[model samples]
Target: MTTIEAPRSRPTRRRGVNWEKWGWLYMRFSGILLVVLIFGHLLVNLFLGDGVSAIDFAFVAGKLADPFWIVWDTLLLWLALIHGANGMRTLTNDYARGKLRVVLLVLLAGATVVLLVLGTLVLTTFDPCIGDSTVDALIEACAAQ
Candidate 1:
């Protein structure tokens, strides 16, 4: 017995902007920006000053004290997370199979959303003095009066 093949047809055209195309463009643009942001962040935090040896809670708290560093770090976090997530989605589409692909993609997207929300909250709502001991040296040096 011979099996019959079903005929294939073209999909109808839509009359609106193609969001997928914009998303693709956005991923590339954000990826380039992330490269710069991430490297600059690393260079400043790990290579500048006394190199990695100077990286402590006090150093980070000092940086977060400034609104400029807060905005810069916040933008870096947002862009890198989004670019990295989109890159993972591309990899997932290339390798994941069948129902497992759908499940993995759903989990990735959910995790990305949760991470972005939490990261943003931390950047925006962070208080350097939140856990400071009353006698903390840096707190006395930097805390707002």
Candidate 2:
């Protein structure tokens, strides 16, 4: 009868901060927050007031005029953008290889940054009176400030 050798232990690896673990955790928490934020946003915008028919430029201007809505939209923009980018990055790492993977990652990062910057700028610097002075209510509101 042949004698079997003892089983080997797992190999040692370098010690460092595990980014994948943090990323996984972030995905879970962010997903939960995103659902709440998205539903609240949809409920207020699409289901309340006059609904879809009331979604004109004036309505958007009014919404953005409030600091609460501005902050809400900014949160929505940043969280959604980063969440999507992280998901796409995970996919890229899993399925892509070589130069293709690098290129995709670079493109994804660039797009995410660009969108975040632009979206934040739009939210923070939005002037509700920039267009369409034809609406009497908007005209009065703009003049009041």
Best by lDDT: 2
The residue-by-residue lDDT of candidate 1 on 8-122, one tens digit each, is: 7555578899866787998989878878888889999889888899988778877888999888888987888877888898899899988999999999999999998998899
The CA lDDT at 135 in model 1 is 44
lDDT of 2 by residue, 70-117 (tens): 999999998889999999999999999999999999999999999999
Q: What's every prediction's RMSD, in angstroms? A: 4.6, 5.7
Q: Report the C-alpha displacement of residue 129, candidate 2, in angstroms.
A: 2.0
Q: Report how far off residue 66 is in candidate 1 (Å).
A: 1.0
Model 1: lDDT equals 0.83
Score candidate 2 by lDDT. 0.90
**What TM-score number comes out for model 2?**
0.83
Off by over 4 Å in 2: 1-13
Clashing pairs in 1: none
Worst 10 residues of 2 by lDDT: 3-12
